[model samples]
Target chain A: MHETAIAKAILDRITDRLNNLHHASNATAVEVRVGEFRNVDPESLSFAFDSLKKEYPTCIACALNLELIETRALCKDGRHEYKASADNAYRCPNCGSAIGTLVSGKELDITKIVVSQNK
Target chain B: MHGPTELHILERLLEDNEQLASHNQEHFDELGLLAVNLMSAPGAGKTSLIKSTAKLMPADCPIAVIEGDMVGELDVERLREDNIPAYQISTGRACHLDAQMVAQLLHTTKLPDCKILFLENVGNLVCPAEFPLGEHLRIVLLSITEGDDKPIKYPVIFHNCDAVIFTKSDLLPFCKFSLEKAKDAISSLNPAVEFFVVSTISGDGLPQWRNWIVEKANKKISHLHIGL
Candidate 1:
């Protein structure tokens, strides 16, 4: 539901990074990384970006490429690491202690922006 | 005529919101307010919990509420009727209240001197999890009527919450809500989250909940001095 807000933020970020490209030039692509625990529907985010990009002349031709990251968890013993789930998430499979530390699963970031350098 | 240049940048998608959230927190700190973000699905007894808490809390513990909704000011009106200091932020299009909206509320409304500030986010289990509004604590309410599978379905919201409150506990007998299952599902996702089963009408867990709020308030006050 708030994907539009995210998209706008990403566009603003890229615009700021572009640094005064006075003449209009199309954005080639924008790469984003969406983690499993982010609760973002990639399709919806892409749809939002597409709709928003059309309104901006610089991003009209831009393509949004989203890479989904899987949820990963580590146990207390540090010997056990696996994908996170509704069950047995924190429990160390070997030691049987509940201390599953989440390493990565909440990453929602714009990794890179590809744009035509002809400004 | 130049080729495409790939500018490597690893930045959070909601970085702007997070920055504003920090700014909001600084303002809250300046005012000595412990802001708590209240979240849940629509009709998950958020308003009831707020009303009941306000009624049962220790009289001297001043509390304020920031109501967020897609539209309308009904919640603010309700709080006013109860003589509770409250403000409202309506995100007409957005499903959830982000930090910027709450910051806007802070700028416009004169919040009373409060130990605790409850920011009741727009009822949502999904989007609200993605946006933080500079809260000292985050509590998500789930009613028995919503079923126990909510934790399984909305893991993000459940995982991010500092506490999980099962509201409308009186309906536990009539509904198929399994408290144990809900707890198990949530614990696997987040072991540290405190769970409370309460029925505002019955006042079953109000005492414990009230105590928790006071403790949090005290902690925040002490932390303010000690810099935590």
Candidate 2:
């Protein structure tokens, strides 16, 4: 549901980058890291990107690379780190503590973008 | 004849949103206002809570509300009926209210002068949690009728909140909801979150809820003065 908004943001950011280039170039791919806690579905994001990219000619042929990250947290005890999943009740396996300091799960960042020089 | 170039840009996709949220926060802070974001599932009694709490707030600390919904201004109308200054943001298809939507409202409309502002986010547990609307406090409402497993099922919303209000406490006898189970689940997700069991109909637990808000608002004002 919110994927459409994210898709638009991605397209807007990439298009801005594309527009800033001195030489003419076509965007080839965009890589984004999505975290588990973001409530974003990969398939839905892909569908939204594909459907919306048509409006932006520079991104018409661009590919989206979504790196889905699992939720990982450090325990309050500062001794244990664990992956949060349904099985573990999203708590630390050793201390049974909730996310004290989140290590990686909330990232929704665009790490890389590939573009081909046009002759 | 160069090949594809890989640009290294490790940037948050929602950076624009984060910036706008800060801007909105600055606006609120500058006005000596404590903005609170209220979120919950559809029909979880967000509006009801606001109506009840507005009456409880002191005369000096006036209250303003910004109601967000996918469509319609019925909630805003309800608040206005009580002579409260309220604005409605009708988000056509979006499930959540982003900082941009709020910024647009702030830029276009003039908000009433008030010490406390309540942003009733679009009634959605999932998407609303992802978008911060420049609020000083985030509160989630879970009615007993919604069942006790909601905190576990929708952990993101429950985890990100500063407080959780168990609404519709009057219906507790009729439903199979376990208050202890719900509190335990939420505590696991958020250890420091404050909890309140409020029944707007019966006027139960309203004093505690009102006191919590007043204390937080006072703290915000104090922080503002000391430039914390």
Candidate 3:
């Protein structure tokens, strides 16, 4: 039940965005921003989308583009920085204080959707 | 018509989940409750600790528990037998518990009027740490039988936790467990996390652990009253 709920939520978000796209554009692309802190499996999401597309034939031609946004942890020292890797360990290069606040990276959103209507 | 065009699909998938978690946090704070997210590997004595803690809680202080498991309501049944208000969250196959699941349970379950609510996360160290459930405190349990390397093997969970509880300390003599090594390893990952070593069976070190919890809970309540 939990797995299906998660799968359905992802698919619903993807398809909702797809259906809301401007029909005038004939582009087959969509950009999804996944936050590093969300900790969702990209492969599982892709698999869910692939299976979801089987029900909606129009989505088969659409290309799903994933953009990973890395989460940054603020260090205790006077250094402001963001992480660029999957590693959640963001330490201050100056003073070795683990007191770092999360700057950004827990974003899971569909930024935009492009559909082809000319074909 | 084959030219490249950019479409920005910026939408936060977890926004709803986060909002719900925040709501749960607010509810807990309003009730003067300290909600704890208990995480550990299976057979790490999470339920045992709950039973012990519940027994030690003050008579006037109401205690409730939210038990998360992949299947079965055995833990819930045990809690019920103990006369504690308990709710079971069976995730079926999910390895971890998320905020949304807890939020749904809070809405559906007939929780007890309590000052402290313990959410025993699905017995896993990995995924539960990934999602925040708006808990005031996150406590990770490590049994001596599980070995000392667990702190290193699962650093993220330890790194994020507010405290660590070393359970099954009574079995230390029977098992090859190194307390100093585990403490050193955990300190390496999270130097600020509080540590409590307790053996439920022998009642050794349980008082200190219980006092720490009571102190923390009292501080939380005081802070709430002060609008902190």
Candidate 4:
């Protein structure tokens, strides 16, 4: 699955960031935001991350925090804001518009990282 | 006593892929090749459509392809048999092709100087949408045999694509697939997405589809010339 690749990327980023820090010993936790439209399963991602992190000493025991964002869209009319879901076929529920500006749900970002400092 | 400190490093997880995708795009731009990424689920007739489109393309405007599959070069062999320059990338374990995979191929191989380069992505619909492979145009195919509810179920892929090709029209009468419902669902997610209905056996929409591709490729060339 692509989640394994994503997990590797996350671990690589974490390790890179840790190495750049002056006194950082290892990463303790990492926070990431994923959107609904990304097709990433949180549980699968977590499992992959946990499995892969063992290879990287810098983030071996790091906890991964995943925040899944909802898919929301703004109608072309610029007034109707609706949750894009299967029920409405991702169209604007109120305006019945086919095209809508996506407000969220495409995000796949690492927001924060916590690291242990070398005393 | 220094404890664990929290650092805010707000960055995209796919930053590497995105950067490489842009680099690949620049390379294609320099070559004046219209890079088209064809993505769809398994067995949606991507290789067949490519073969049909290659046949329809003008003699002056040639086409090359980079086929992605989980294993084997069956599609690549098929394309090569038709005298189409094709390369195969067997993505072991990975469900989708990333920009890096394409970048490596570009580095290793020298493709024929064609007006268009078609990248037929691996057969999965879900993960391929997440990775951008430096394509100027992205198209998704939906075979009628796959049912009309696919667009609604996989909205992300449908929404991000430039167009959708409804394939296997020859079997439409036998299947319960409704073109109207499929179009409605996809247009709801992406109103700008163009639709093409076709069957490789009958060549129903091959001409129109070929024309659209040629027009787009010419437009790309002209647009670059104008910029210069």
Q: Report lDDT per candidate.
A: 0.82, 0.88, 0.72, 0.89
What does the lDDT come to for candidate 2? 0.88
Per-residue lDDT value at A60 in model 2:
93
* TM values, all candidates: 0.93, 0.95, 0.79, 0.96
- RMSD to truth, every model: 2.9, 2.7, 4.6, 3.0
Residue B55, model 4: Cα distance from true site in angstroms: 1.1
The true-versus-predicted C-alpha distance at residue B43 of model 1, in Å, is 0.4
Query: Model 3 segments beyond 4 Å from truth?
Result: A1-9, A22-45, A48-58, A61-114, B1-5, B174-176, B221-228
Select the stronger candidate by lDDT from 1 and 2. Answer: 2
Q: Write the per-residue lDDT of candidate 1 for residues B128-206, one digit (tens) a residue.
A: 9888888888899999999898888888888777789999998888999899989987877777789989998799998
DockQ versus reference, model 2: 0.66
What C-alpha lDDT does candidate 4 achieve relative to the native structure? 0.89
- By TM-score, highest first, what's the ranking? 4, 2, 1, 3
**Candidate 3 C-alpha lDDT tens digits along B30-53:** 777889889999999989898888
Model 3 agreement with the true structure over A1-119: per-residue lDDT tens digits: 23233445555665665566565334365567766555466677666666665665556666666777765666645545645232333344456445355566656667776655543
DockQ values per model: 0.62, 0.66, 0.32, 0.67
TM-score of 2: 0.95
lDDT of 3 at B122: 92
TM-score for chain B considered on its own, for each of the candidates: 0.94, 0.94, 0.91, 0.95
In the range B1-228, model 4's lDDT, one tens digit per residue, is 588889897888877888888888888988889999899999999999999999999988899999999999999999999999999999999999989999999999988899999999999889988888888888999999999999988888898877899999999989999999999999888887899999999999999999998999989832111000
Tens-digit lDDT string for candidate 2 (A30-71): 999999978898999999999999999989999999999998
